[model samples]
Target: MKVSEALSSRRSVRGFLDKPVDLDTLRRVLAFAARAPSGGNVQPWNIVVITGEPKQVLVNAVALKIATGEREFPEYTVYPEALPDPYRTRRFGVGELLYANLGIPRADKAGRLAWFTANFRFFNAPVGLFVHTPTYMGLPQWADLGIYLQSVMLMLREEGLDSCPQECWVTWPETVRRFVPIPDGHLLYTGMSIGYADPDEAANRTNAERAPVDETTTFLGF
Candidate 1:
């Protein structure tokens, strides 16, 4: 698929079909996605891919923790303490759109929380990837990881697969560490679910809007 097509089609798919992804295809996608640029050639992204029994085990463990009201201190904050202006509103808007599609009203806090637990199960996707980085890496390295992740997502689209790049997984750093063999000195940065999207699911039908280029960009030299 063309780059433009991939970018246009790629969305944070929340529902996945039961079919498994081909391991060979996944490896090739990851290998090619590593070509994504990093500052000073420091390719800082590390990924632990899991599926089948291991993935289910991790999901069960996190479910137990959630049941017992256990919590882990996150390795890093996913968002600022107090987000400002358009950024904050944009975040809220997407979430509202998602829950609305799921038939969840703003008043249904419990329903929303229950739906959120699906992130641990990778939204029933067959493949799960946990991204990590050395704890010492700063903002620039983190940004590189985002670029690498975008490349992976786009390539998944090229292969007729879908994915959800989940920052929510960072909330269970300790639980994930117990299940995945993340290298020493590295922190779990995020997770992703990759598989065929469930076209019939309402959550999969939600498409969040984006700000126009004129609103988000500036043409200084043009």
Candidate 2:
């Protein structure tokens, strides 16, 4: 697919088909995705991709915690305590749009919470990729990680697959550590669900909005 097509096709897909993602396709995506630029060639991203039994085991561990009405204090703040104007509004808008598509009313708190459990379930995706980095990696290295993951998503799009980059996994560090093998120095940064999208799922029909370039960009020398 052309780069423009890949960028346009990519979205945070909330539901996936049971069909297996071809392993060779995933490998090709990753090989090119790793070419994402890193400062001074210090590529800090570490990835652990799981499917089948291993992915199910990890999902079960996280779901078990939620089933018991438990919450794990996330190692990092997923969002600000009080997000600033435009961003806060954008976040709220997307949630409203998604729930609306799911036929969930604003009053359906229980329904909404139940639906959230699907994050750990990988939205029924067959493949789960956990991204990590060494504990000592600074903010710039973390930025590099984001670039790399976006490349992964675009490549998946190119491969006629979809993905959702989930920071929700950050809340289940212990559960992930127990089930996913990681070297001593690494810390779980995020998780990604990758697979064929279920076209019939209403939750996947999100009308997520983005700011216009004029509103978001500050042209200094254009």
Quote each prediction's TM-score.
0.98, 0.97
**Cα error, candidate 1, residue 214 (Å):** 0.9
Each prediction's RMSD to truth: 0.8, 1.0
Off by over 4 Å in 1: none
Off by over 4 Å in 2: none
Q: Which candidate's TM-score is highest?
A: 1
Per-candidate local distance difference test: 0.95, 0.92
Q: Which digits, one per residue and each the tens of the lDDT, describe model 1 over residues 91-114?
A: 999999999899999999999999
Clash pairs detected, candidate 1: none
- RMSD of model 1, in Å? 0.8
What TM-score, to 2 decimals, does candidate 1 have?
A: 0.98
Looking at model 2, which ten-residue stretch has the lowest summed lDDT?
69-78
